[model samples]
Target: MSPPAVPEPFRWTASPCGLVLECRPLEGIAPHLFTTRDAPLSAADLWRRVGRALDAERVATLDQVHGRDVVTIGPGAPPPAGRPKADALVSIDPSVAVAVLAADCVPLLLADRRSGAVAAVHAGWRGTAAGVAISAVEALERRLGVKPRDVTAAIGPSIGACCYEVGHDVRHAFEAARHAAHLLDRWFVSREPGTGIRESKRLHLDLVAANRDQLVFAGVPEAQIHACGLCTAMHLDVLTSYRAEREKAGRIAGAIRCRAYNPA
Candidate 1:
């Protein structure tokens, strides 16, 4: 079956930011999008969404290494480095559209209406364990002078707990992280039961839940966060999953740029 058409065509903006993009014409915040190696489509297919007149050279990508590092790109900001070991990108200039490519990792988008500052982040188990979302929130508050309460955060599709199975290392990482300590038992549950016979166990990591906690911990209000609980692994008809697609899978992109400045 063909993938469902995107809703909203490209308009998925709230007050202040003045802009949004969708995957398809009707898909909210769907354009300004690209396919991953896990999706049904590939980067070559993404070109169609970008338009025939656009140049592929304009698209930027990083070697994302699951770290809390963030880069600023605007005006004279240097071009993106080869898969920089980072998770977040921030900019106040509307010309630049901050993007994050992910198969199951949380596609986090942050925008401040007052300053027109926007951020795109890739937060996965490692990223969440490393506090990448918190880093993005901090960057917005410090660099953009945005009140944490006013920042609108959108936590896009990712691998939900039902599909994410983790190892001890994953659980340990969260335990080692500062604020993550509270969700220890809750984050990691034993798949096996019975006394003295612990055969197997798994970390049912709720990456989105963890990120939401991080946002709130950083002072973002609950109402400001918009989480689209669409699981990539569960929705093959709409999303792409690296775990399911492996190397041959196509990717899905989450992107945003300032639009109030657009005269068109």
Candidate 2:
């Protein structure tokens, strides 16, 4: 299949059976993509599609419990018995692709420019509050010896602040996460009065901003972090969004792979 024509920051690239979005900054360093709603419907089919697109021999994903746990995969590591209960996957093996699925949550991909190590993070509000992005960076540093300064991240299409309204409970969640409390004011926007009823006077949570800030706090340079800026809630035609589609919403995935090892 030929690469489809896509807009700025995201380019269409032929997968085995369909086209996926490739972040320009991550090109060459890692074979990664942010899949759209046009991709396959089933999890197995989606994995196969991603494998074909990147020519990866194997792919790894998670059960994605909105937490900070990071699962590591490599050459000698045993195959995952089941979807591990984690929100992030990291690997230095070129043949293995790590992916994360999300509907409204941020699907974040990170790559180490020097080591070629990569990670896929599923950062929903809960995971964001738990510092999932920072956890991924720390995992890379601890497991692969990749420093945060050398890492580049791409925050994929998700529910942007414009449409992600939340209640005080959401604010309380972040506030309770003392490590993230200082950043809450910047990530949450309180809706003005008359916008709706009392309960609807919600705060809009910026998942992307929260994740980006966490990455920066983890030491990734602000300029190296790229956000797709495509709001899933706003771009229903090309993306799936839980906020806009409710239970009927399908998921989009963000995947990344290391460069093939060359011993020569």
TM-scores of all candidate predictions against the true structure: 0.76, 0.90
lDDT of prediction 2: 0.84
Cα distance off (Å), candidate 1, residue 30: 12
lDDT of each: 0.63, 0.84
What lDDT, from 0 to 1, does candidate 1 have? 0.63
Worst 10 residues of 2 by lDDT: 1-10
Could you give candidate 1's per-residue lDDT for residues 1-264 as a string of tens digits?
Answer: 433333332223321111222323212222243333232334354433433212223434456788899887654675565656678887654444556778888888776655666677888888888889889888877755667776677777788888888887777677678654556655555545552212455546788888888898889888767676667788766567888777755566666654332111
Worst 10 residues of 1 by lDDT: 14-23
Name the candidate that leads on lDDT: 2
lDDT of 2 by residue, 1-264 (tens): 233344476676666646567889888689888888778456567788787677788788899899999998864775486799999998877878899999999999999988888899999999998999999999988877887898889988899999999888887888788855557878987677665322556788889889889999999999889887888988777788998998889899898888863211
Q: List the residue pairs that clash in candidate 2.
A: 15-53, 16-53
Q: So what's the TM-score on candidate 2?
A: 0.90
Candidate 2's C-alpha runs over 4 A off are 1-8, 180-182, 193-200, 261-264
